[model samples]
Target chain A: MIANILDGIVLGLQFGLLAAGLTLVYGLGGVLNLAYGQMAVISAIVITLALSAGVPVLLAVALGLFVGGLAGLILDLTILRPVYRLRGEPRVLLSLLLTLGVSFIIDGFLNWRYPLETLSLRIPGEAVEILGVPMRRGSLIASAITLVTFAALFGFFRYTSLGRAVRSVIQDQEGARLVGIYPHRMLRLILVLSGVLAGLVAVTRSMVTPVDAQSGLSITVFALIVTVVGGLGNVAGALLAGIILGIVSVIAANLIGTYISLIILLAAAALTILIRPAGLLGVKE
Target chain B: MLKVKSLSAGYQGNDVVHQVDFEVGSGEAVMIIGSNGAGKTTLFRAMCGLLVPSSGQVFFEGTDISGAPAERIARLGLRFVAAERHLFPQMTVHENLLLGANPYRPDPKTMSLILDLFPRLAERRRQHAGTMSGGEQQMLAVGRALMSKPRLLVLDEPSTGLAPLLAQAAYEALGALRKQGLTVLVAEQQVPLAMSFSERGYVLENGYIKLQGTAQELAANPIVRRAYLGVT
Candidate 1:
């Protein structure tokens, strides 16, 4: 039971990071990047390719994260900014469709490039026992890394000028603009931040579970569920929701079947929608 | 410090402010007093570059700022306080004030000056803006604008929703800023209060400037008295 709980926490932290990225992008850009998972997949592929080419693991990981940030910047410069120029529901609708289209394009390209092969990061290390429960070293490291990243981000939002500008934009875009904050620049920075987060998740998760091109949709769906349950723009809430979902999924899978976990997650999402659409910590608009 | 010539602006195809012309000299306090739908808000929006005028020019300190982005215009030192207290309701009063100082880098002296100007805000600096009463929020919005240390400060309906005493206090704060040589342009519905502080007053009705003169001259005008002041 303890081991299962630990596993859930590990997975939950991963999910929380993805949801944080989703929340910021949606909050500022007013667009849900359904392609968010593909961005991760692309970073994972970059890291895998670099490792195969005999690059050191540390440099390969850095390169992969950079690939993610650059991809986010490119997408923002190309597609997302135009969609943002629109107002109201049409903007939201168009942004969704565009990201959906981009996701498909990425999937198609990756499948074409690396057909019939699954990929994973090979961070060679030995399993370690904690309180008589053996834990995979990679998973433990991933959890630690995730926690540190979240802590750093919390500080950034609280203390940095750019970070406060982001929060201000989240609070009121018009108010942000009035104070000489350019929404476009803030959007670019957020996309880059989100992309870097996706890269971290991709690198960490792929170390334990090999990923194929087809996995992006499922990952994004899980992220969407976690984000909706947490509160669309509430970062801390998303983290808590991720952990709760992770624990529940682990317990449910152990008692029933692996398929039951996904079902339970979907049900939880539906319950949130029906009962409290603003989410656990969502501010009512 | 500010000039508007033949300014025509509106929402959609309908022109709400038609061929309006005005000038505010440096360090001057001016008021545009008009009833609801008199296009005061629209005029302020145009001046701030929040809305692109269909035709006309807005010059601030001899620079044509008519079509500049609102953020760019603000960086150039003309600050606008919207009619609604547009505070970041989720953030603390300190955070809102910090953002007001965004165009210029945050400075301790400026923040201290703003807090001194409104002591109630200082007491509640850590409090979220949304939880504040309407009067407090208005003070916060104006205080946030002053954080930028603007050369020309434009306020839209600063007195519209405040209690009588709160409204008096707000104008008193504005009067203090005026004494500090900050040029102020107030668009208000309350004719008497606005005219009391302004050296010049413009009477706007249905998007046209009906009268412009020294505050005393317009305050004494027969039509101004009958229509606005409830004077027979």
Candidate 2:
């Protein structure tokens, strides 16, 4: 039971990273990029392909991460910007469709490239024993990576000028503009940051489980659930919600079956919607 | 210093402010007074570049700023405090004030001055801005704008919803800022209060400037008194 719980937490922390990206985009751009998961999957694929081409693992991972940032920038410039000029329900519906369409295109290309194969990272380390628990060395490393990344993110928002500008834009676009902070420029930075985060999640998760081309959709769905359960645009909520969801899923799977986990997730999301539409930590606008 | 030449602007496809013209010299206080929906806010929006004018130009310090983006205008040392009081509610008062000074390296003296100007805000400096009362939030909005030490400060309905005492207090604060040589362009619906502070005033009606004069002259004009000052 402890091992199952630990596994769930490991998965949850990685999901937290992905959900944070999604929430940031939605908060700033009001766009739920369905292509978000594809961005991660593409990073994984790039690393795998580089390794196959005789590239070292570290260099391949670096290249994959770089692509992630580039993909985010491209998406922002091409797809999200024009849609953001719109208002009301039209803006919401249109951006949703546009991102979904992009998701399909990415998924199709990835499927063509990899077919039915899956990719996994092989770290050269032995499992470690801690307090009577035998832990996979890779999981321990992934947790460490998540912790460092989260800390860095916190520091960026709290201390850096660019990060503060992003926060101001998220709070009120016109207000930010009045203070000489351009929302569009901030939006670009956010998308790039989002890409970087998704890339990190890709590399970390691919270490533990095999990631296939079709994995993008499931990843996107899980992240979306976590974001919703946490609160739409709340970063801390996403992190907390991710862990809770992770624990609940594992417990549900243990008590019933793997299929019951989905039911549990859906229920949590439904309860949140009915009781707290703004989300647990979402600021009521 | 600011100048507006035949400025016309509005929302969507409709023009709410048409061919309005005005000017304000450096360190001068000018008021644009109008009834609700008489284009005061709309004109302010165009001047700040939140709305592009359909026709006309705005020059700030002789630079043609018409159609320039709001951020660009703000960078040029003109700050607009919208009447909505768009404070980052989740953030503390100190953080909000810090963001106001974000364009330039923040000065501790300016923060101290703003805190002095709004003692209520200083008392709640550590509190989240959104939790404050409306009057307190309004003060914070104006105080935040002052954080940048703007060359020109534009206020939209600064005391629109406040109690009479709060409104008086807000104007007194502005009066103190004016004494410090802050060039101000204020849009107001409260005719008497506005005229009391401004050296010059313009009366806007249906998107056009119906009258313009020295504050005392406009205040004493029988027509102005009957129409806007609630007197026979």
Residue lDDT tens for model 2, A155-236: 8887877777888888888899999998888878888888878888888887777887888888888888888888876788
Model 1 misplacement above 4 A: A116-118, A122-126, A130-132
Candidate 1 structure quality by residue, lDDT tens digits, A121-187: 6567778888677888888888888899889888988888888899888888878878889988888
In model 1, residue pairs whose N, Cα or C atoms come closer than 3 Å (at least 3 residues apart or on different chains), thus clashing, are: none
DockQ of each: 0.78, 0.83
Per-chain TM-score of chain A in candidate 2 equals 0.95
Task: Summarize candidate 2's per-residue lDDT along B1-232 as a digit string, tens digits.
Answer: 8999999999888999999999999989999998998999999999998998899999999999999999999999999999997888888898899999978877999999999999998899899988999999999999889999999999999987899999988999999999998999899998888887999989999999999999999999898898889999
- Segments in model 2 whose C-alpha atoms lie over 4 Å from true places: A124-126
In terms of TM-score, the best-performing candidate is: 1
TM-score for chain B considered on its own, for each of the candidates: 0.98, 0.98
